[model samples]
Target: MNKNQPTRPDGTRDFSPEVMAKRNYILQTIRAVYQRYGFLPLETPAMENLDVLTGKYGDEGDQLIFKILNSGDFLKDLPADAVTSMGSKKMASKIAGKALRYDLTVPFARYVVMNRGTLTFPFKRYQIQPVWRGDRPQKGRYREFYQCDADVVGTDSLLCEAEIILMINEVLGKLGVQNFQVKINHRQILNGIAEAIGAMDKFSDICVGIDKLDKIGLDKVMQELADRGVSGESIAQLKPILAFEGNLQEKLTYLTTLFENSPNGQKGLADMRAITQMLNSFAQAKDFPTDLHIDFDLTLARGLSYYTGAIFEVKVEGVQVGSISGGGRYDDLTGAFGVPDLPGVGFSFGIDRLYDALEELNLFPAEATVATQILMIGFDEASFAYCLPYLYELRQAGFATELYPTVEKKIKKPMSYANNRGIPFAVLAGSDEMQVGEFSVKNMLSGEQQRVKAGELKTFFATK
Candidate 1:
């Protein structure tokens, strides 16, 4: 092994059994809920053609794509100018023509485009897979991690947004999340605000600042907006939206006045009204994890250039990890794939962040720590012979039981192995105990051993 190889690459990890148990629990729950919504499972290759991925996620995102270099004598015919631009834009295409996919959506678009002649419309699929990015590793951002995603393509129905939110509520609710909140915003609404404030042409720049409102806070965000060439009158018209509050409708009332002459603003307000109503009809606080709320804030702009419709972010209470799940509608997401007007909306459940949340809440059951239900003990040579059948019986009865492989080790030695593995129960078949048609069952947790008959072994573990 290379000395440089570490336990995990930077921005990556190796989950222990304890962590994997909790993580798998979260994933299984998400899978069940996603299937309930009728999303079929789909998976794409871990890597995709560089042309398929480049320019899809913006310049920064393109940089984050983990490009695979040309293999076997890669530099033999490289152009001098191409060699000069190593690690720059031109060289990326010449030397690295493919990349580890940054997200599932782009690849899905490419797949649909390539297979357009043979597929059905409104394809709904769920993909749970590892995606890679070159992002700086931190507490919640990992370069490689599984994103449990579900998306529906070929429809622009607001009903889909409602359903997506409903799915989010169901997944988190089943995962024992009760204090998190889902922050909802529309790209149209954000654009509307820019138009109303006479900064329509500067919508992109305005969005960059507003999206940072939470990260840098209001004061710094305002300074950033001013630096972007926003005028005092425009800023004044934007202030009320930046500070709007009350119920969903009240927020819309204020927006109506602010965007009185802006037609696009009118459409955005109408879309928000319909989406909020749809969400309310299905997602009730009594049934959902976090109470759903919609507010008018110029600062909720999602940073993606592709999000042309509704967008959202989720935060769980008492958890320090950033948005555990987030996504939005992309009307022309498949446009680059030559399938324009195929609107799609979806969300990604960041399994790692949710793992952190579950950890913070201590929601996993106590029994989740064990990798096996029973550990067969090595009492003596005769005991090992007598215990083999019992081990098979335990295995057949749906308990994961393992026998100690080496007969050379003393009983204490193997027992220590069981303890180290967190195996809770142990079966001992000593010579005397074997002849009596009963075995000693040890509760490793309590160190209490009891004589249990062979016939009753399965029954004994039923409750556990």
Candidate 2:
């Protein structure tokens, strides 16, 4: 790459108009589903006070937050002698006071804490915005990408968790995702496994390692735990739990016995049972089919320490990408900010990953990419002038209508533009047709042409 050449930053992308259309299609589908579930829209600033985001997502997540340098001479505050010798950690603390949010959930907790008095109870809100991270980029991952999230706070109902499962299915179903699985587990259950194995003090370390199980494999995860100071004896006890296999009921029964002396484990098991029962009733009432794709995995730890209860991860089959969506229940996320005991549950759809999955499966509908519905072409100046009012009328009637900017002697130029844009219809008119107060409407797909009076263009497209 030339040094002087303009380029997008690595791990970011410039979306073409066509790509934007497809992305908007996905966003609209998600927004619609969120609205149907009674979630209102919300937005937060791109940068937050660094402290607000720092300790919320656990150590691994905290490291990925994109910090913003202080404005003007950032090093002025450092002592002259210490500036040259300060450690990286100390320098970072002194120089950066703001950072891009790592995710929506933490900032949301802060928001609830700040605005608790003015907000309604059990507030349900949805946010669609771009979040920045310092993560390594890959096929489905990016340094900057949009997260479409819907969350409900101020309630501890397991019904919220069940409804989230239903919304996950509905969003994917509407987006034409054919095969996907929503993997769910409870943080309490993970905690129980830690307790039963006698590694309760190292729970967070264990979670951070187990969360990498799918990516790093079991042997590597055990090694990571040992590196994090987990005992060999605890690892031995945890192996069978991590490798537990059975149907959902059997998994629940297995946990019931393992959690006999663990309160967190028992509560987690009861929550799972209540959530699943509500899900069945909700599905039956809504006439939503059950595919049994929602699975219970003993090793499913979501790494984020904030997730206190149910956690979810949605994976699409046949796509070489990571989970397209994930979130969990946070009973006291707001407590850190002085608002205690507010329980909330939510999930976010990784729009970029979902876009990748849909593209891989060729699931995007033809209409999703269509921008202009009709392009009007003129053989000469008079016909072109005549198209101006019809353009206004067609647009007034809710058609995406465009008239060629100038008359061209060669007909192929305008036709080619329409074809390249996937415009389905074209109106062709010459001096003769304009003189008769009529236009030629051509179906670009069938190449079929019809002559209609100027007053009838709207009605003509109305049928289409």
Candidate 3:
């Protein structure tokens, strides 16, 4: 490859047709599940006001937002000192007023706040769109990728949370992800832990450090807390909580006593219990995955600061990748936009990582990548013209049919095209076949050829 050749920017990708087909398979599965749960489709602008995105994603996330430079003379309005001496942060605010959205949830909150009066209460909406993050590119992480999100606003019902869990099971199962754990935690639980450890003032630091417990070990996390100004005494107190382990009931019992004096912790425990109880009832009465383990992980603190209630992160076993999906309840996300009292809970499916996992596991079905059922090839112009009506008829009969472009004198060219594209069937139309009032249909896989009349093409492919 020449160095001078123009290339795609780092951290982004150009998806070929084959990759897109499999991606669409994942998207369709998620969309169907969302619709089954009664979520209407929604879309928001790709760019949001810089202020709307800046303070929402925490300090680390704010750094990853891709800002758009102001058009025209952006610096013309700034003072000479402001233009030359201001730090990057201050200059950024003055120079860039818009940025690509970091995630769908914040923009959804902005949308709900703007359209509150015209919308129904408890609005259930699903948004599947690309997001941009200016982080270093790595396997399963991208600067530009799509998120499939489903959310319910205007209600604080724990049922929404329960339903979200059920949907998680359904969506992953449908996508053929066999071994995955839906790790659940709550913000108040972390708060209670902070209070128990006397690190109340350092709750955010604690959550951020704890979120890395899986990647970095507990000792490092404790050291990080200390480095972040957490008390040595508090670190000692939190060690036991970090090492605590048990079944769901056992963990709940332990936390109940630990948080007995903490009302926020108690509230979190109540919500967790209620949501699990609902899930259990469904398992007993309906078609639920009996083996689905709701792992109550204390260290699963999603780094997003907006999550005010339950937080969730799903890890796929047997795959060396990050969480494939995550989300949580936000009691006042819309409130940030001046619409208070609209509590909501939701989750997002990270399609890019999910695709990687599925591809690695070889779970995508063969039919998922089949773009065309048949390709019609002709050896001459008249023969190609003859395939036009047949192409129309096959498509009308609900078959994905396509006429091979160009007029090739030899069968080698068209046959190579069909074989390379994995097109299952090919209809060969020549003067002889047209004269006989029939077409030569060949199965590209088996090399089985059969002469079928024009009227019988539909039935012929249908039976195959």
Candidate 4:
């Protein structure tokens, strides 16, 4: 490693101003939708106690958690034999007591438990923040990424699920994501399938394989099940359920019949039916734009162990990228912390993946990249000093304005700076314009120039 040469760690990145502008655009758009739905803003620390995060995301997610070593002689208390003989995983547990948060949901659950006395029930909150995962980085996958989450806790009403779906539709529409579908499922349905196959002990094992269905197809999923010691008989019984096909109603009817022997399955089917019916009713009542679509994907088993009912995953149309957003209902997520029976349902927009999908589809608006609206150029020291007041005035008038730093800088440099920064208009005030009390405004886009008195500068730009 060349110490002098700057480099970010692997699976991480630095966002330049342009990139940050686009990111902010995405964040603000989602934030607007979240606020419109009555979700107040929330924030939690980047790190949480290891226990709070460990069992929530299932085995794979636990392995991805970036553990933070206990500070100040982490290994001080370990026995010499243990320190010398333990493997990396065992050693890590001995030395690490905290970890970078894996996701917002767990931390939110912890927060609710700690602050339950102050907060009202059914608290709705939106959190936009980065999470760390020690996973291999690839396309649409990152070790560090922001999850835009909105969750409503303490309510079991399917209306919460319906409203979340509507918010998802409105948010994607506003972001110009034209093609996408919200795939809905229930955890109870998966449980019912496990019970039906008499593999209740292998529920997690089965879900682990089934969750990969979309990524690795049916054949591979079957082979994986076999490798995991799932009997051929169970696979045979489970295969048709995985391959079940039909419209939402038809699929539900089929599942109702298939899971008829399993009460969990029947309950899950009824829950799914209720939520979809609520969604249909909402669609009928509101004039929703025609861009959004919802589908009942029986195969969608969000791998997280906490999700209990009404799970959701969003896939962009015509894009091979993975789901852009996903979440589900969690009952008693706070129960482990002694705050039992609090039900919450929410979804997270995988901001990075969403950005990549939007970029691939050319969905970002052109204005999202423009940083400065006006750049003021000064030909000489005296003229540059003269332009400062106008720069201040323009900013006061609610325009994104900038002044050339030094009058000693050449005119070409200032023009180039403005051009490079995508400033749409340039205010050119030199000795002549300073004396005349007028400024020449150059339209960066059209190459049109016009003279305007100082008093009319704001009005001129305002009209444009």
Best by lDDT: 3
Off by over 4 Å in 1: 1-7, 79-82, 85-88, 283-298
For candidate 4, write residues 1-464 as lDDT tens digits.
78799877779988898789889999999999999999999999999988888877768888999999899998788888885689777887878989999989889999999999999978999999999999999876778888999999989988888888888898888898877899888899999999998888888889889999988999999999999989899999999888878998898888777787999998898888788777667667557565348888878898747788889999998876789999899887788788788988988998888888888898889888877899998898888888888898899999999998887555888898888878889999988898889999999999999899988899998998
Q: Model 4, stretches more than 4 Å misplaced?
A: 1-3, 55-63, 69-82, 85-96, 289-292
Error of 3 at 361 (Å): 1.6
Q: For candidate 1, write residues 320-421 as lDDT tens digits.
A: 887898888888768887778888888888888888888889888775565787988767788888888878988998999999876745688879888998
Name the regions of candidate 2 deviating beyond 4 angstroms. 1-4, 57-63, 69-82, 85-97
Q: What C-alpha lDDT do the candidate models reach, one value each?
A: 0.82, 0.89, 0.90, 0.87
TM-scores of the candidates are 0.93, 0.91, 0.94, 0.92
User: How do the residues 371-462 of candidate 3 rate in per-residue lDDT, one tens digit apiece?
Assistant: 88999998899999999998999999999988988997678987898889888999999999999889999998899898999889999989
- Could you give candidate 2's per-residue lDDT for residues 1-464 as a string of tens digits? 78799888889999999899899999999999999999999999999999998877768778898888999999898988665699765687789999998888778888888889899989999999999989899867789989998999989999999988888889999887879999999999998999999999999999989999999999999999999999999999988889988989999999899999999999999999999898777766655776746988777788756789999999999998789999999888688888788888999998998888899899999877778999999898878888888999999999999998988889999999999888999999998898899999899999999899999989988998
Residue 357 of model 1: what lDDT? Answer: 84
Q: Is candidate 2 or candidate 3 better by lDDT?
A: 3
Judged by TM-score relative to the true structure, which candidate is superior, 1 or 2? 1
Q: At residue 115, give the lDDT of candidate 1.
A: 80
Ranking by lDDT: 3, 2, 4, 1
Model 3 / residue 156 / CA error / Å: 1.4
How many backbone overlaps does candidate 4 show? 0
